[model samples]
Target: MFKLLLFCFLIGITVGIGLLTTFLYANTSIVNQVFLRDKYSKLQCIWLLVFLTGCSLLLYYTFSSQALYYSLIFMNPSLEPLQFWDALWVVGITDFVVKFYFMGLKCLILLVPSVMMSHKCKGFWYMCLEEISQYYCTLVSTPVWFRYLIDYGAQTSRAEWHFGILLALLYLIIKLFFVFGQWKTSADVLRLFFTQPSYGMAATKRQCSEAEDICAICQAEFTKPIVLVCQHIFCEECICLWFNREKTCPLCRTVISSHNHKYKDGATSLQLRLF
Candidate 1:
């Protein structure tokens, strides 16, 4: 009865946490919009604090569970049965807490400066957070092949550790190559945005007459209108702002250019497929 009750309690906590996270994520756009428009708000500050606290709690839980699982698997054979509280105290405090501290430190390094900088840097911190979240999720939900490799390594003798380490290093090297490729692609896109007028050509009178006179982005009369490949016309300044956050034609969703980086929303995807 006690075990069943404990399980039920855990499930309830998990569901509640999931719901809270979803709600916070749903409101992120509103928070960003408010921050950009108004500069600051007391309620938005509280919401951000709550969201960050929730993230920290989730990180703690993940690290604690991982530490406990590994500790159980690798407990000294000669050591008597591990006491739950003792193991939790020793492993959780030493290993999990240290790991969580470093993770939090990384986040602060990425975020603190952006917050302290000009209001124009609003999207920068959000993009950094998204990248960090993507990396965290990828680490926690490793590929099946990598899991199998880790399991084999865990079960092997000390002599096999070197071989496993070598394999892990090789895997990291290959992954780094892909990451480099992505970085290169991003650099090209950045160059295109700066050095070239890839947004579009100036809209001719004929083009302007055919398309809407008002820029879709700013919802105002077009100034220095540029017609994109999709035949949609927008103000150069308005389209530039839109392209900063999106690479698609606002009307038709056509990709802006071949140099456009692979993006979902404004955040660049760091996800890689092992298969």
Candidate 2:
């Protein structure tokens, strides 16, 4: 009774996470961990990963041992005794391919959200990934164990970042092809667009003279101009604060009819021209 109860509890916990992971896999809702908000959800995914691997391994050994019993081991006339040479040549390839398969699968859960989220996470991207992961997971038909060995095995220490690297390579190949085509077309368009005779000589070194306008106060670029309603310019920031009340031009010191004045740009440059 005690052991059965423990088993039931573990099964319940696993089912809960399975439901949660499936639901939230696409939900970008914040994981809500104070410091690790963006990353905590991923860390939580560690649970799904453990569950997947354990189930896969258990089912795989069960089926394979039973189905391929004698053929897998005892030397037949064909390929006797699985030995050092077998391990070196045959096992190496098989192991790599199998591991690679799992790593590739790991990429679905690992890289999809990770790469998708930060810069630009789109709904369609997740949708496409879900369809693919589910589709392949279903198509394999073999127990999930086979999928685990092939995909997950490649993801770990056996090939450190194996799937990530492979996925990157695949993307690079695709991007390079797309980029090459785009550049080829853009180059042709650029050639035709720039050939018009109205286009002045390709490269004329026309020199520009810098304006010598200097501020009256700081003597700066006059870069900071405070032109007034009468089109008179002042450097009020450089000047004293009393000018706002003066209602008169400073340089000419002419008393203006009204206190309201406009900047040369036609803006009511009130306090802006003062303080």
Candidate 3:
């Protein structure tokens, strides 16, 4: 009866966490879609991730032996303590590692190009890793205590408590550092967008064709127009906002750069003075 109740409780917790993860994943997908407008198929990826994560957790607490057998095929850990919590412990650890480690690896792959992954990918990975770690820690702490309660009818040992606390603290520290870095990088990128003048601004003095004066981005008159290296022009603010989500110009699909591209802001100061 005790084992059954414990199992039910664990299942409930797993289901609840799964639901929360799904909710968060959906919210993130929606936000990205609104802001990015189909630049990438991130929603599909998130859906896959959420599905895999929930499946991992479900397999861990329930029918984890098959997964463990395949996952640890070469390791050959002894399973003699099956009647005890050994199987559960192995399942929990394996599940946590398989799911979270791969997710972390994906995030690392995303980061290889730039730390500015602080954009959207960073937060997604952080939330995912945090969830995985939370589940792992709970699994690590709960089973031993529950086993003690069931077997000896006593509380867990002081050593177990200390170990659990230390593990939790360590995980907390790592999560905090990661979250801080992500937020800091995101803030820096945002600051860059706000501080720098747009490449389009250099073209404000140019004569507008009946169509050229209108900004494609905002569908308004270019108030402080900037020109891309590709010679496409837009309102400075509009282009800057667009560039935050995508590096390419809205019209020509030319990749805009923060530096070194020639801009045609109508005329130079020398030309103005000469005129």
Candidate 4:
């Protein structure tokens, strides 16, 4: 009966979180705009507060639950059922809290530094972190027998933690190598956009006429327009903004350049599935 109740509670929590996440994702654009704007309605502010509170609670509960479960498994390899109070005692007195604290600290270490970095490098670093975390989750989600093997090995020696630290260090080194390459590419794209005459050339009267004297991006008359290789014309500012997030012409979808653009606004999703 206890197990059944616990399972039902987990299911209910999962369903509720999932529904909330779906709603937020569906209105992601509106949420973003509301948060970014200097002035927003009172309701929007309330909703934003609710969103942040939900995220904080979710993170807290997830890490706490994971730590409790892992500590239980480490203590009782056979996974014996326990009374609710017994489980709570194990969670409080064991290494669970320490592990949970470190997990949260590690996330902050990864996120705070990236947030402080320049816009050009922030997205790349975030992407690298996301990849590393996805790989970690894949390892964590391996078969139960594999996890047991890991646990057994960990119990035998302290080398497992050292090995994990070394592995993470090596991965960071490799990712840093790629980061430099990406930074160079982004710099070159910026230089080309600003320095190249072809990219910023003024649209002639004939070109403007051919484009119906309008910039398709802003849905208004052309202003300091530029023509692309695909013959699509747009306001230089408008196109520059578009190119920051995309690599193709907005209208024809033709490849604008071989170089990739940095993420727009240095913004990235904070959902790191470390479990």
RMSD of each: 9.0, 25.0, 16.9, 10.7
Instruction: Give me the displacement of residue 167 in model 1, in angstroms.
Output: 3.4
The predicted structure with the larger TM-score, 1 or 3, is 1
| Model 4 residue 85 CA deviation in Å | 20
Model 2 agreement with the true structure over 129-181: per-residue lDDT tens digits:
33333333322222222222334335357574465456545645654575565
The lDDT leader among the candidates is 1
| Candidate 2, residue 274: how far the Cα is off, in Å | 81
Report every candidate's CA lDDT: 0.48, 0.34, 0.47, 0.47
The runs of at least 3 residues in candidate 2 whose Cα sits more than 4 Å from the true structure, single-residue gaps closed, are: 1-39, 66-125, 137-275
How do the predictions measure up, each by TM-score? 0.44, 0.23, 0.36, 0.41
Per-residue error (Å), model 2, residue 67: 4.8
Q: How many angstroms is residue 59 displaced in model 4 relative to the true structure, after the best TM-score fit?
A: 4.8
Judged by whole-model lDDT over C-alpha atoms, candidate 4 comes out at 0.47
Tell me how candidate 3 scores on lDDT.
0.47
Clashing pairs in 1: none
Once model 3 is optimally superposed onto the true structure by TM-score, how far is the C-alpha of residue 6 displaced, in angstroms? 8.5
Clashing residue pairs in candidate 4 (N, C-alpha, C atoms within 3 angstroms): none
Candidate 4 Cα outliers beyond 4 Å, as residue runs: 1-16, 19-27, 30-46, 57-212, 240-246, 250-254, 261-275
| Clash number by candidate, in order | 0, 9, 6, 0
